[model samples]
Target: MANLYAGIEGGGTHSILVLLNQSGEIVYKGEGPGLNKWLIGLEECVSRIGKMIRRAIDGIHMKSGIPLKSVGLALAGSEHEKSKRELKELMMDKFDWIESVESCTDAQCALSMISKSGAGMLLISGTGSCCQIINPDGVSRQCGGWGNILGDEGSAYWISFKAIKTILNHEDGLETSLHDISYIKEAIHKYFEVEDNTGFMEIFYAKSDARKVAGFCVEVAKGATKVKDGLCLHLFCEAGRYLAKHITAQLSSIDEKILSAPEGLQIVCVGSVFKSWELLQKGFMQVLQEYKSKKNLKNISLLRLNQSVAVGAAFHGARSVDQILPLEYSKNATVFSQIEL
Candidate 1:
């Protein structure tokens, strides 16, 4: 009898679960919230994740009439060994017939999706940002990922941070382009619903809540787009540069061959930033080109999309199950069908 396997990819903003047959094909997939243990609290995160995973499994069973054999969880908060161990325990306690459970940091899952070789560099920019490199020998070098406070350079939070600063500057007459963004003004009015600048100050500045302040990015972006504000475009460009700086910083420390031309190191970009920002993508590519030209290194080739991160988590789950099931089980597994080359 073939056994079932499960994979969960949890990020700062969302979670993805995949159910795979013994073969590489994905039988079921589900998405949910980010299980950041630090932010959501360990118990709450686990409960939310448990519910999502159960939903996916239940959906798969309804479709296929079978239970999962094993579960693999890859998320942002499992960077430490203790965290990974705790996460595994959490899964084992919540799930049944789960012969085994594996937990790893999000970066490991990203690397797995790159290939079974599981060695390469990955740049992730979403609610947060980070760069990870794995050597042929499995030695890893990581840069950035300092969170939103001191780090998270080029992250969505960072972009929003700067955008808000610009807005503040405009309010003070230090900048000019912001007044044109009525959409932004509207979002602020709705969120803080202030009647004027004085009301806005009373709600935002008086309370000094960072998360509340960060919430304004969406309004700013939406408004800028509606008004055709060039300032938003400039913000994205700057976000790209900020992101590139982190990538280059890591690239500088690694061997040139890893970043070289054909057969060079493959950099896989994973996360929301890659999904949403065309300007960011263009700017990142342009900066890489300039860096390669200046350093006389070969151009880098990026492989795989950000969605692969979840695919990778599922793949890892399959691997964990493979350890117990007959090798034939994996032969029938489903590879990602919708992925474009």
Candidate 2:
């Protein structure tokens, strides 16, 4: 039987599992719910992930007639040391083809894929936002990534909050450009089951966390796009700009030597915020253009990965078994076909 490699990518919304062969061809793929231990109960999350892993292995055996030998997982909630230990334990209890199990936070995998040299910056804005910078000397510094509450400035929730605030201001006669699409208003009202501003306020009054309130952004963005609200458009742009600004601040924190260092610096952007919001993407580029021109630094280049973090996770997993896996494995790997599920 041919040897098989296993890779798993876990995110807030979903999980992807892939099986690849020595030839860098994917033999199987499996998917399941998001595996963030915080979002989903840890026990439930691990159970779901285990099921997906089992399915992936079985699929690979069925398709390629190979026995699985190694598995690597890139987990969404694996940032904390405690969480990583727990995730590793959860995986250890599962299927036996796993000779060695390797795991890493999803962000690291994303950064690795963007910068094969491991020296670059990646801004990931999905349900949350974070900026990662890797210097030529292999020194790394992180900025933002405060999650939905203290940070996540350029996230969908942030934009949605702005849009809602603008709508409310218009209604209160505080602004003139107040635009409304019944679709959005209605959806928000239905989702919250609130009749008017008064009711919405009641819900706001009930829940104090900004993250909880920001949950309304994606649905609203989808609804408002149909109605063509100028205000909604502005909100997207603002969110994007906000994300870019955060990146700028992070970049500024880097040592001047790191900035001007001969080694190449790579910036990677991940997360849903960048992927889902058009405004955020535009704003990020605008901010980058301005920052680069102002700094006169030519060593940094931003990379936008076409593949989702899951692909990176899978690659991370594959590399764990053999850290020396040629860099081309990721580029030529058959993982993409298995990822679609």
Candidate 3:
């Protein structure tokens, strides 16, 4: 029987479900709502995830007669042990045939997407930002990810937060722009179709919503990057530094005696924040280089692109179904195909 594997990359905003075959090719893909149990409650989260998984399974079963053998999920709210256990138990109740079911945080999933050694750092800067370090002994530590209220310094929300403040300051005759981005204000106005202060208020004051404001980072990034806004560039640079600080913090916590990094640590990044942007990545890399040089450490290297996070989950699931392996081990990116979103 040609069994299948399922990977569900669940986040605060959206969830992606992917099915992989024996050769690790994507067979079916589907999407569902987020699995943040804290926000949506445990029952709803599990229900939505179960629905999406079944949909993907049904799609593949009809076309290829593949029975789903295992499922590996990386969910947003599963970072805590209690949440992880809750999600795992709920999922197990629904899916019993899945012999090797495993669940963990989404960052851990992103980590699985890259390295097979299971001992590397993963920096995820999407709507939120966090740096995770996993040593050889399977100990994991995190930096940032304090959510929108307290932390997440080098994330999309942070970038958008600073960009909006600059805009409002400029409107108030504060001239907070870093460079000649006058054209950007016009572009932003056109994009959002805001003609007056009232329009601006409506955009920002639409219930004082953080996500509504943070969502504008995409537009702000385009405009600022196009016009070469110095302030925007500065923000990304700062973001890189802040992210490096977190990475370095994790590095300091690790006992150098056990970890054998003959060369240096390889940091893998995944998320919407780092996808296809020259200025941000450039800024990020530059800061990292400077930081490592000054610290006189082994010097960390970056993989930059972190594709196939969901596919990584699928690979682990498939592996679990096939053999008795370590519950927490990394898988290589080369073993999986591109996870088409």
Residue 321 of model 1, lDDT score: 57
Against the true structure, candidate 1 reaches a TM-score of: 0.78
Off by over 4 Å in 1: 62-67, 94-96, 173-227, 255-257, 261-263, 281-286, 293-296, 304-308, 321-341
Which tens-of-lDDT digit does each residue in 1-341 have in candidate 1? 35567778776677888766666566778889777787677788789876876687677555333456667777876767898888788767865546777775566676666455567787777777888877667777778877676688777777766665566677788877633555455555676666766765655457644445445555555644565566666667777887777767776566554554355556677765554455566566667666765564554555545354555666666667554222222232222211111
For 1-341, candidate 3 gives per-residue lDDT tens digits of: 36677788776667788877666667788777756666578899888976787677666555323346778877665678877777778777866655567675555666655556556777777777788877767788888777766787878878777765667787788875655556556655675677854676776556554455556667766665686666666767667667667776776766563233553566677667765345565555565566564444654455654245666666666665563222233334322111111
- For model 2, what is the alpha-carbon lDDT of residue 247? 66
lDDT of model 2 at position 170: 66
Clashes of 3: 0
Q: How many clashes would you count in candidate 1?
A: 12
Question: Which clashing pairs does model 3 show?
Answer: none
Q: Estimate each model's TM-score.
A: 0.78, 0.75, 0.78
- What tens digits encode model 2's per-residue C-alpha lDDT throughout 88-204? 776667644456667765556666664465555667666666676666576666677665556777776566666666657766888855455445566667766777878767655
